[model samples]
Target: MTRPSPAPLRVLDLTDDLGAHAARLFVGTGADVVRLERAGTGAARSRAEELHWHAGKRVQRIADEAVLDARIAELAAGADVVLESGPTSRLRTPALREADPSVWADVVHVLVTPFGRTGPRRDWLADDVVLSAAGGMAWLGGDPGAAPEPPPRQQAEQLAGAHAAIGAWLALLARDRTGSGQLVEVSAQEAVAATLETGAIAWIHGRSVPGRTSGIYGHVAHRVFPAADGHVAGGYSGSPRMWDDLLAWMVETGEAEDLAEPQWQDGEHRWSGRPHVDEVVARFAARRSVAEIAEQGRTRALPWAEVAPPSRLVENPQLAHRDFMVEIDAPEGRLHDVGLPFESPALPRPVRLAAPADLPAGAGWAQGRAPVTTRVPRPGTPRHGGALEGVRVLDLTWVLAGPYVTKTFADHGAEIVKVESSQRKDPTRFAPGMRLRPGASYDDSGYFLNFNRGKRSLALNLRTSRGQELLRALVPHVDVVVENFSPGVLARWDLAYDQLRDLNPEVVLVSMAGVGQDGPWRSAVTFADTLAAMSGLTYETGSATRPPQGLTFGLGDMVAANAAVAAALERLHRGEGGHVDLSQLEAMAAALGPAALEAELGQTVRPRSTVMRCAGEDRWLAVGACPADELDAAVRALGAGSLADLAAASDADELAGRLQALGVPAYAVRDGHDLVEVDPQLAARGFYTPLDHPIAGPVLHEGLVEHLEATPGALRTPAPLLGQHTEELLTELLGLDPAELNTLHEEGVLQ
Candidate 1:
């Protein structure tokens, strides 16, 4: 028997590699993706690299004024949204807007650019490396002494596209309410800037520019210790209790005697002499295998795991049990990769993305292709609203994904009472410099300061019944709770989603577990934003076939955060706010939505060839993946006779146009110098927010995703200080009497 058609989503997929990826995500989400191919030769068709991103999209070719106008009319009349990565200047072109006058006010239009539509360089050309440099991500990677190395691959562009997808949904909601759509403009540079960890704050407040530190560990006390089997990135320092547990393990393992030495006796001394300290730890770890160290760490309740690559990650037990990784037979063969970024336990077919692909038209042509299965929403009452507003959320989310989602609610005016267990504190609180002292107020890790902005903080001990009781009492008064805990921790405290939902039926719980909460691989797996590398994303990145490299920023986590925001928005629309089983793994998978369809079809979407350097005079004029035949012609058209000759000509738009007119596919490479020099479109869009922090002065915040006609979300206040609004919230929202509030403070329940 034949199944019914899948549900529809409005997507305007523009030309380019990044746009292809973004469009694919919506396709996976069961959207009707319409890829707008160029009018003539359709260079995108020749770029096999784009096939992975275009799996579920329906190809529609349109060029020039007349044809585009008809196409735009048809699309705007039917589509729910439009996704574009071209210049806003292009959008403003009469011919372009004439085709879809309804697009701006009737449907969500997501515009993606290297620099936002309004920045000075909006018209400038950019490749992944150039945009990464402009966004400041390059400053924090690579060897300290060498030039700031570019990020691994297409991260800047890909991330902006993901954010653009979320932004589209937000605009769509507003359209659903107000009957008017707005422009959602995204800048690869700006999106990437948000993911630079604490580097921006360090330069702004600390007056220190964070230089590159390749192979150096992040601020968290994680390290890759030696084992008989392989290296493990362990020594998680989530809390003091965790540290104490680790110490106890060392003692039990007969390594405590080393701590008695003057060099290791004091925490400060040991930290100061990290070289020697690491040597000691390394020596001890060498005697054991990764399994032994991990097993001991797990049993002792210390967060520990070995650093694993993609090949190993697919087989991890924690991920397997949780169904974090799913296998769908492609047209060619069965392949394993990460599943959804979030799981709706309520959904009937949770693990399946779509049906598998049929046999290829030709042998090598279908070597790596798969059939996809699409989801059709069970006919039911559709829901809508501030699914999370009025719901008190105690955001324990830190870093990118968690905080960004909570921030979305905060933008919607949610009361987020954040809890910062002082024992280990948020790492961003001590970034740039791992400086933490008992009474230091300057301890603001730009990471913690910026992300925690607009939230109240309460110091508590979940291990203590008093703390747990306070949380329990607060839960009844709250509507939703969010956390990014490792697997199994919440269940141990009897405070998992089920327990919370049981106490409050309307409460919505979101867990940003690194892997997820279920599956054979659930507890056995541990990961961060780097999951992109393991999920076949990185496998198809770069110009070469070397082991896939990890992205420089936390794209995986941030994208997941956006997904949670979308889910919350969807829930709110349904008027039924309940439990949400969110997983970072799932979020990442959702962004790879199109790929899942392709994977199910058994197709292998190989990574594109990275353009390391161009055949030109200026080393900066890099052209990656330029078609073979067009290389020489492209060089001549740009007036660059050779690699050295390429330096003289700066503008690639003309060259791009010429190539397009001739039916050759090509895009100009960009970097820091180029970003600063050209691009006038971004300034017109007004995408940057200037901030003046009391400590970190002259900070620039990115503009909101879209400019709403009414009640647009804006940055009302900077990030808050610890308990800065405790008294205000107590008296204003809860109506607590001053005398009673004083009592609570004295009782150690209030900060």
Candidate 2:
């Protein structure tokens, strides 16, 4: 049977890396993309190189204002989806939606920027540094006295790009059922902040800033050590078993007599004496090549890998076998880049497009596109059937990573008590896009709403004696307490895990820090999401032609949050109570995954540009998605016609319908419409609800998490107004009488 036609995606391709990457991903996923470019920064070579990002897109250059305005209006009316970077300001989306609400409502508009669309810093100039610094990334990087380093590359921007892509996909999925679309605001700052790993978690628990350190590699027994050949690689000898295996391997190979004590033969014994073990391992490694050591280590199942450079990575065997790199033909030449890592058993390969070579000079580009055709619902509250149901989490996290992990648990089914100090609310409360009026409270921020949903908030002054008493009173009710603070912070607060364990031994505690609890640099440095950039993740991205750019958003923080969630799940599964030290840098380092393995083998890889040109226009094609033997046959699949013509058999709606008929996944890209208009996945999952807000009228909101055949969790009410539940909670949880509550309120203990 013939495959179904592709979907229609409309993108306002601002001349930025984030927007470019978003457009590129959309096209790769079988959407017919239309891109809008302007005159400024229109360098011929730069424009030519855009082909690497615009391969599957049709481009148009905006010239005169009159023509541009008319074309934009026409395009917005016709487009199914809309994506923009710098152009998305408070002024743009609302005005356009008002002009033709029906047409605009059918479009999923994604605004990508350094800050969100409505924050105090929304109008400020931003790239990586500004975003990262404002997002509190710089606060945790390098040494406290040293100049703050931005991510080594353009991280904030790349995170923005990734989120832009994800937000668009999610919006489109939402639109599939509700027959409308909504504006998706993405902030590079918030994205970066979101990836602070456990730093924020510790802030919630310990009220301290997580510090940074040099190349300690985080958690477990990991670090980058010099090999015999003057190359560096990561090695994990922290585990008792791994340490024992390494010693045994050395002894078995007849290389064990370098003056190390015999107690090193046992894993537990060695872990306690890391310094001695390090000295012996360093000496032994001085006589072996990285590859030889790595091979031998792998043979013995010891975690070790050489540090690899970008240029050499293009030919890395494991990555090649996994098809992690793709080559797209562009005007400049073929460009190589990292491809999507997530894969499904059914869909093995995604079609890659090369950017086009040229566009009509001064042609009005923002014209001719179809609108969103589906109306999927928003995702809702957690279901009772989740594995975490009945679990109680004492969420002491602020900012990003810690909050994010706890939020995931809340999304699933855990009851979360998000404890914060009024003196230091989560930065996001004041960071951006808070729909605050002249005298609104902290709850007005969209950032707070987005991450803290379905969680209870408790404002406590942890620095006060009374606050300490309150926490001690509350300890017995919680199953877990998670924090991300600098070393010694919780201990300083007299709330260390040991102290807490004395009160409730069954309670699990997870500590997230920039570095682990033990390391030479543990107290000397700080780190943030940008830690990924410094640890060679960014260096592995972008083209060799330019310095590696940071991912457009705070990916390191996000990845770390996922790791934290996974770790939490693991701990819960074991049903063992202990402290879990999650190092932010270690989590970010782990995202490097196989790359770490290759690095340990003493290989280096290069970061080649993915921007290129195609089809007499500027576009980017996947560098080598078409197999060597199937290139000619695949090219023939384009069917010798304009992309629009190839899609002529049906509009986006009919195409999706046909694809669904064939049991394949497909949907149209859409513009600013409603919360629900084009999300097929949401429809399939039943994840949206129309809720009436006091000010926003009846609007679509995210629905429930997970589907259960039996019992399920439910949200009886939306997040309560600030202080709305104060009385009930105080009366019930604290067993306070009305008169006592009034006295406490008068004493400023409760808001």
Candidate 3:
């Protein structure tokens, strides 16, 4: 299959390390990017960071900011897109528009900042540690009743960069409709908060305030465990079937003890049976090698993986088979870089090029190709309120990761007809955030409500021929089809991408799974918790002294969801049909930033996280990635004796403020209550939007997270009720009459 190339774009990248990932993404998607900055400061901080971020971009540097605005406007004149970010605002679009409105007015310009342009904390001092805490990620990981630790590397900044890419694409799509350029404003803090998943939802929608559980899920052990050869992530205790299978294995091995008791068989009993069950599981794990345990667990269908560090990612079987790790062409020798987050035919490879060579002045990126054309609506055509107004998508997805993809676009006014089943519903419909309203059923779940908003549900049994025919018929009506079933499940039902292509040649198809459509572990039953461990993140999660803790928040969902949305949108922009084969494994691994690149070069893995106690009970402050100059002054300010004693006397907010005053990066970790109620930055951004649900009543939701100056999206409606739009959707999309709808309903194919 020939990979389809993205529409070629010219981008003037006026960003530092914070916006590096966005520029890299642009390059990967066939954009010609010129990295412009002052001469000395333009050099990357480290070698691996340089290779990972700037491999395929052209570089141009000047002595200083003298004539910088003039140069920026000149570059903007030739560019289709302009990108910038900040420790301080670069304000590229405003400056360009100020200088020459006619030239820069129609350019798609994206500006990414730590806190966004309008928020009160927009100018606050921030780094990885400060952003992590303020964004609500630092509140979830680490040990319970202790200071939460930020993830090892550049988690916050990288996530913001990905969101910046999403915003830029959305703007490009809008540009096609509006006949103008755009200002895409992205907030690193909001991007991190948007992906907190249920951590923030547990408070926003439900009254439940979830706290750090160390590495345990309620009463069960949820972290990595020991093996004779090495540690493995093996402490899952969910699902009745998994528990039964595990108990049987334990009993057969003469290690079951009293777990065979009748009461112990109940899942609720097992949840509370943690300490005892944890000891038994640990004992069993200690007796086996990681190889023995992983192999044996695989045959039994357990969510198990060897907890590999960054150094071992290249040798991972699934990754190696998928070619996710590739060598870079550097002047010195062949260096390594983590490959593209997703694999798709017709899309460009995530190349690792060397330091950019100097190009002639006024050199255009390509010989002579017109800018990608835009739709020009004739005079007096009604404008679209949302950028994706006419777009339609058939959503064959459930759970966290898949739902997130549709949710991102649905917010942009894309009409999504979600194909569900009455027989077997999406499990998240019954998961956490269950509202306390009376007479709640499958449709009453807050998890379902938050993720499925602005979607119409069509209940169809794919197991039946009539249902398959209906789905194939509807394929021609939609612009895209997205699904996350295990690899090949669609083929069995005659609904794979090939089948969809037969129905509509111009339809874009996106198939995402844990390990992707092709790989040794393609069919593995997996979840985000296990994907976390397998991505080499879990091995680097905890403090340096302790064994790495499990990542319960499941960041892989957001990573893959963002990539899938960006890829799908880019494909749609070309007005062509293509298939995006995405793997959550590669997606999550790619989010490790430059950690994998460093480890690939044989550098010793850096230590993970830092924690300091502060005033009040269970209160703490997180600080790290501090500059060398600030470290000593920060230490001296705190004075001699334990850090705990010094910080415990000062309020966390006040202490963080003082540190920030000294140019040291620090932030008091905000909890769920604090975030929704008192986080000034969140309030200033209007990040929390209230939605009135038919079942769950009125609740606050994370509305359109990005700021698009031209065509900002809306939370159009609450998530649909199960099978709520069955008849209406059929009639609208398929032109099915009332009689046909009733007949299908009678046959139990449409419910």
lDDT top scorer? 3
- Residues 1-751 of candidate 1: C-alpha lDDT, one tens digit per residue: 1233223555656636445445655655566566555557355332223334554445656456665655655565556677777544455223455554654456666677666655444555565655665565554544444444455436666667666766676665555455565666667766766665545544434445444444344444544465677555455345556546666677777985565455554555655666665676677778888678767765665656554544454566655655665444445444554454554333323344332222221111212112223222212212223312244676767656788888766654456777655453555564334322223253344555556554676655566666676666667666567887776777777788788867776566777766566654355434452345335444333323222233444556667787787666544433345656676655654444335434444445443422232334322222334456676676576566663344334445344445434443333443322222332333355444555555554454444553333435655456666556666655644466999777777866554
Q: How many backbone collisions does model 3 have?
A: 3
What is the C-alpha local distance difference test score of each model? 0.54, 0.50, 0.75
**lDDT value, candidate 2, whole model:** 0.50
Q: How do the candidates rank by TM-score, highest first?
A: 3, 1, 2
- Clashing residue pairs, backbone N/CA/C < 3 A, model 3: 3-345, 3-346, 4-346
Residue 440 lDDT, candidate 3, scale 0-100: 53
Deviation (Å) of 564 in candidate 1:
3.1
lDDT of 2 by residue, 1-751 (tens): 1112223345554436545555655554445566665555445333323434555566776667556556566666666667767623423445666777776766777667644555333454444444554444544443233333344434555555655665554444345434556666666554554454333423322233344433333223454455776343434433356556676777876776752466655555655776666666677787888677656654665655544454454564534543444455655456554443232122234334565545454443344544334321112223354435556788788766787777766755677777776665455564322322233346644335445666777766676666666666666667688887777877877788888888777677877775456644344233342344334565554334433333323456665565555445434433445567666655554334234333333334323211112232111111211123443333245342332333343454344334333322222321112113433333333334444434333433344322221223343333434444556655656676999877766766664
C-alpha lDDT of residue 376 in model 3: 39
Model 2, which residues run further than 4 Å from truth? 1-12, 42-52, 87-94, 139-145, 237-239, 253-276, 343-352, 357-751
Please give, for residues 621-659, the per-residue lDDT of candidate 3 as tens digits. Answer: 876566455666676776735445667788888887777
Model 3 scores a TM of 0.93
